[model samples]
Target: MKTPLSPKSTSGLRGEYAGAGDDFTVEQDWQSYSPEAHDRWRRLYAAQSALAARYAAPQFLEGLAKLDSAGGIPRFDDANRVLQAETRWTLVAVPGFIPDAVFFDHLAHRRFPVTRWLREEHELDYLVEPDVFHDFFGHVPMLLDPRIADFLEMYGRAGEKAMAMGALDMLARIYWYTIEFGLVREEGGLKVFGAGIVSSAGETVYAIEDEAVLRLPFDPERVMRTAYSIDNFQQNYFVLDSLDQLIGSLVGLDFGPIYERWRHEQPLPAGQLQAGETPFKAVRLESLGERTP
Candidate 1:
């Protein structure tokens, strides 16, 4: 991968808060996409779907089926038809990741900004920043759930609040661990809800089956206090009992205090156990012990 980290810009869209100097808008060239571009989407879709089917959360899989997303690159208009009816969420086009505020603002309004660009064929397995496939296929399907839909809006506002308090680093941890790399326990077994897992074949299984990754109970404060890495496979996967459990706890939190405490605290390394003493086998056995009957 020559460039795993791709610079994403928000395409200019009139927003109530958009300022003159903001460089957030991403330019789109929808008509310029070639046959190879669409094929890449198909190839990734076929590959990731097979791997994720066993590892991904049932909700994510069900929503994906509801969206009828097996086809190649999803057209925003067609995707909106199903998404709007399912959760009233719409996918809008952006060049890439928009500015923090703009990104949050769009989510607050239930408008998800999907990059108009797809990853190159060689870059299918990974892309540093979110691309169209990451945005639409990975994240969009989950919006079909009513609870998750509301949670994302709240997540956006929480992000804005974190920015205002200069605590976005803390807030990003919450986003990274949950929205990007979260796992959930289902009747059958551990399943993936995180977009990062859904989009990557390697992570889809590693996040759930890898004994090296710590599977912690979902606590908003713990998540906010925890630090995460963006450049590699996650060393920890926060496990949620359910989406309701994850979102319900965050509705009333005021993170200013949380961030303040985090400032003085040392961040836990990716695979660090609670007390930082355990081999992967011990950690796995401990996890099995914590589950409910």
Candidate 2:
């Protein structure tokens, strides 16, 4: 029997970020944070960490404990010691979002570009752009899982090829639905592993408990044709049988022809499911129209 999901909250907005690096990385100024800044990190961590303990994937929980992020915002070197040892991955400080090619290159090399700042005291609940907490607290933990790590590198390699094929958008959708907002079925049932959903206190609850939205089984080809918003809660989500399924889906699958076909097909709207789709779990998104903008 599937376990019912518990309630959490949905999320809001994006913002601007500042990175000190010139090309793709910046020196993480470990000593520059103020007492107030640490306090902000503490508040954010205490709340999100509590939620993560309850809702995040088991692997993420394990990684979070290994990193010891509860003290405050983590120094890149401090976390790197454990990450490099575990999965050969490292986090680099960045001002904000980098170019697509640069971002992909980082992943290909097993390096993740983390935005270097924290959200202000007032903006703790939501921010327009990903801050340090969002990047590291939300994403880096999962990088410790070996299979997910390998798949990430493969994703980066595929992304570069997709860019050349003009299927970058198609590929971005894949990243959004999988890496950022994916759900995986476990012994207990559908659990989310995506950073975007895990990081936000609200999205943490909304993604799982709210049955008003579509939670279709993952189909990469179908995902490639879907649209999304950078500033809002996802209109749709895709579920995986397991993270292993995620890696399995891409193994020996070529996108060269998939991109050609996708390029000519009209994009699917963000909030609608395609006809003939069977929901692995029947859910009703009755509150979909009542969401915060």
Candidate 3:
């Protein structure tokens, strides 16, 4: 992968934010997409859907069915039709990434900001920055689930407050380990749920099936103190038993004191469990040597 990370932040939208002032939203420019771009969308959507059907959460697949964007690049208006009809959520067009404040505000209001561009033909296997396929294909489908929808909205709201406490790093970790690369247990087996995993072909294979990456039960405090990679497959993937439990995890967070206590601690290594946690035999990797840094 030639990327620094998947599209984690909304701030990299380049200069297109100039006109939107603080909101940073723009038209989808649905007609401006070249035939080649749409073709890229078709190919990526086909491949990812096939892979995700096997690895993605059931609700994620359901979202894709509802959105109906598998055959080609979907118009923002069209996707909104389904999103609004089902979840009362909508996709907003953006130029690549947007500022965090703007991004959170959009999410807080049930609006998902999707980038309107596609990755180049040359970088099909991997790209440095997130494209339309990653944002929409990787993420949108799962938004249909009520718990995830509500959880994300709360995340955005809490995130806005966390920023004032100078604890955005702690908050971003929650988004990273949960929203971008989270796993969930189903039928006693772990399955992929994070956007960063389902969208990437390699990760879709490596995350659940690899047996090389350690899987730990979700712990918000541990997740906040842990460091993660922005450039490669993750060494540690957190697992949540259910969406209700995930939402429950945030019920009584007093992040200020937690942040102050662990804020300056050395980041937990990506490949190792800390002192308080144990490597359950069922979730431990098959070969620790195969893990990444």
Candidate 4:
């Protein structure tokens, strides 16, 4: 028999929906979407696709192409056909952000919870909360890559332990820095792999081009101890040398010592380097003979 999903509070969630299961999943009901919604999706796709080609990681670009989502909001079932084949991942519709444990449970099982609603047209450039466009467009493409696919499952598995240890804050920072706002060195320059960067047109340019923002080399411990900003563009981005390094760094690694050591320590401020730390100098896009769009 299937385990019953426990009741969860919906307070602070912004997505409009009804009939969510105990797990907070709802049917995509793809046909119910209005033409205006589809058009909004198309506009978002058109604008972000251009930025992605210029600034996004090759894996993201390849995955975006494979998903074929440029026309409108993609049917989850259609995208699942490709996603499941590529990485055994599938999208499940949800009203919005669910509880952390529920969210982690879905990831642990390779079920990604995508919000079932789209953002308003006026809110295109920025939305305070993640809408379907942010979840599906920004996140699902990376799920197609095996490295990220594996890492996310591992992350989900780690969540329970984190919660029990009272270390969710530390674990969440890892997710925030790497999965949501990560940068990677590719083609002799920095390219975005983070979903947060890929989905926002303004941030796509700002993340890579802005001289004011600090880019730091990926250090799991430092990342966990660092604070992040959700209300604005990230002041700091963690740069990975390669996806392989990201996987290898955390696989079979114990976070116990790190958490124990730093759990009581004050969080490092975002955007400021600690004494004796040096920032990573990104290879300029112009140096690679690529023009910014």
Instruction: Supply every candidate's count of residue pairs whose N, Cα or C atoms clash at under 3 angstroms.
Output: 6, 14, 2, 0
Residue 128, candidate 2: C-alpha displacement in angstroms: 1.6
Q: How far off is model 1, as Cα RMSD?
A: 6.0
Best by TM-score: 4
lDDT of 4 by residue, 7-85 (tens): 3545555654457887788899899999999999999999999889889999999999999998999999999999999
Mind giving the per-residue lDDT tens digits that candidate 1 earns over 205-274?
Answer: 6776676567787878777667677788887777887888877778777678888778567776666667
Q: Who wins the lDDT comparison?
A: 4
Determine which window of 10 residues in candidate 3 has minimal summed lDDT.
Answer: 1-10
Winner of 2 and 3 under TM-score: 3
Q: What are the per-model C-alpha RMSD values against the true structure?
A: 6.0, 8.4, 5.2, 3.2
Weakest 10 consecutive residues, lDDT, candidate 1? 1-10
Candidate 3 colliding pairs, count: 2
**Model 2 accuracy (lDDT, Cα):** 0.78
Q: What lDDT tens digits, residue by residue, belong to model 2 across residues 93-173?
A: 876656777778888899888877788888877776778888888888898899888988898888778889888889888
lDDT for model 3, please.
0.78
Candidate 4 backbone collisions, by pair = none
TM-score of 3: 0.89
1 or 2: which has the higher TM-score? 2
Q: Model 4: how far is 98 from its true place, Å?
A: 0.4
Cα deviation of 44 in candidate 2 (Å)?
0.9
